[model samples]
Target: MSRRDAEDLEAAPDLIAEGARVLSGADIEGARFEAKIILAHILATKPSRVVINADPLAPDSISRFRELVSKRASRVPLQYVIGTHDFMGLMLACRPGVFVPRPETEVLVETVLGSLRPGRDRPTVADVGCGSGAIAVAIAHHLPGAAVHAVDISADAVRLTAENARRLGLAQSVRVYEGHLLDPLLAAGVADELDAIVANLPYIPSGEIDGLAPEISKHEPREALDGGPDGLMYFRKLVSQIEALPPRRRLVALEVGLGQARQVARLLQSGLECSAIEMRRDHGGIERIVLGFIDSQSH
Candidate 1:
């Protein structure tokens, strides 16, 4: 390591207090919470357990802890540094190229789940742009009979999604595919057979991407963030594809960017013969989810 890294490791604190102080000095918000988490990770213990036992750090462990702290202080995403993230109560493995699941996307999952029929067993669902398989895994986990087909354009995302599905014990129920949007599903002859579809596609305007926080603009993949010039390019493509599906009652749920919900809804209405269209707000009160149902008679 560098000279400064070695010195920091040598002088690393043993207790949580010192770690928190060091993180605070680095201007990391929620210093105490983050310190406890980092220490717990280095010690291979739970965060709750760390609170009950305040023990001195071993020299090796201290060095590892300091290194993790340094990475966090440098604005590496906490999830990427820790190697996992929580989504819908399930721990999902995260990596550099794959997109991280956000808390706001949970609402989209709920909307899709709520659209399920009461007596349907083994309903087929597709998660377009299934980054890291968060939505696919969560849906399969919650709805035991759901057969989830997850698609992503990025090979890295496809691999991560499969890994997460296997790790979560939903490998048998969630199928992973690599292709743009719903193309894989269509190619597999399941396009017209789907019961529901969900997507958390890229929706950030290309020009505005540079203005995003370093954690997002720098750390997250641009293909997963840039939604083209107006941020509606992918949405337009997705709506067109969904509209082409054969006449059937299928639920379609999507997560959109701020102020894009209305435009998305209009696009959906114009492109698809929707029996109903509903908008749901995220915790931040921003209209986030756009849901629509295509009735069988619309064919």
Candidate 2:
């Protein structure tokens, strides 16, 4: 019998653990969970159940598990294989082409909530380039009273964001619009009225995208990752548009690439400067968030 066939005779739990050990040694975090998920899928059982029973997997299940291990070993992002990721403590539905929401983006949400907290009133918020609706849905869930608007340049992103909003029960409050940057909201004449505008826009330069990890370079959409030349294309456009708005009590937050915080902050001209900009550090101590607020002087 093949190795897969042998597994059908109640493959030993220790054997599965062996596979997990190999993957772990290869620097794959959550090895057991990965192993369990693949095994469970092949067995047609829940991952949780796979843990409780410790039952040997069948031949087909073992074969499938090995294939997943090979893929994971190739440095494929775990989220891509699992088809979902936990962001802001929520399970967001993810897909191959959609930009995978990074954990550091949570700072953008927190910054918005912190600023809005003092007012203690419902505010209209916009998440430009709302890939996967991670930022928009998280805000809506955190502040149930807020009206959230999300827009993405990519149609695929718009569809994914809409689906995620619906899945998270924030569809009513989080409106997903398909358009570039602020176009959708401006078309609706709601740009100037926003209390907060947040985004995790593409900051990777067009040429640099090819150097990104395969999980991003090979799998994610170019329009969602490429930020044109110098990686400041979108920021320049966003800053210019935001500055034109008649000064209102508006806060703008963006997730910037490494070492781009200072440059991004500088783009906030029209009296908006670093003082008005708050820098947030990510888990890796990189300056990740550039938050600027509209003040009376800017008007």
Against the reference, the lDDT scores of all candidates come to: 0.87, 0.80
- Report the lDDT tens digits of candidate 1 across residue range 87-188: 989999998888989999998898777778565567899999999999999999989988999999999999999999999899999999999888989999
lDDT of 1 at 298: 74
Off by over 4 Å in 2: 1-9, 12-53, 58-64, 71-75, 270-275, 296-299
Q: Which ten residues in a row have the lowest lDDT in candidate 2?
A: 268-277
- lDDT (Cα, tens digit) per residue for candidate 2, span 1-299: 67656656554445457658867977777887777776665566667777634555565555666777777667666666667777889889887778888878887788778888788478999999998989999999999899999999888889998999899888899988898889899999888788888988888888899887766777778888878888889998888788777777678888999899988887864435423667899889999988887764563
Winning model by lDDT: 1
Compute the lDDT of residue 259 as modeled in candidate 1: 96
Local error of candidate 2 at residue 30 (angstroms) = 6.0
TM-scores for the candidates: 0.92, 0.86
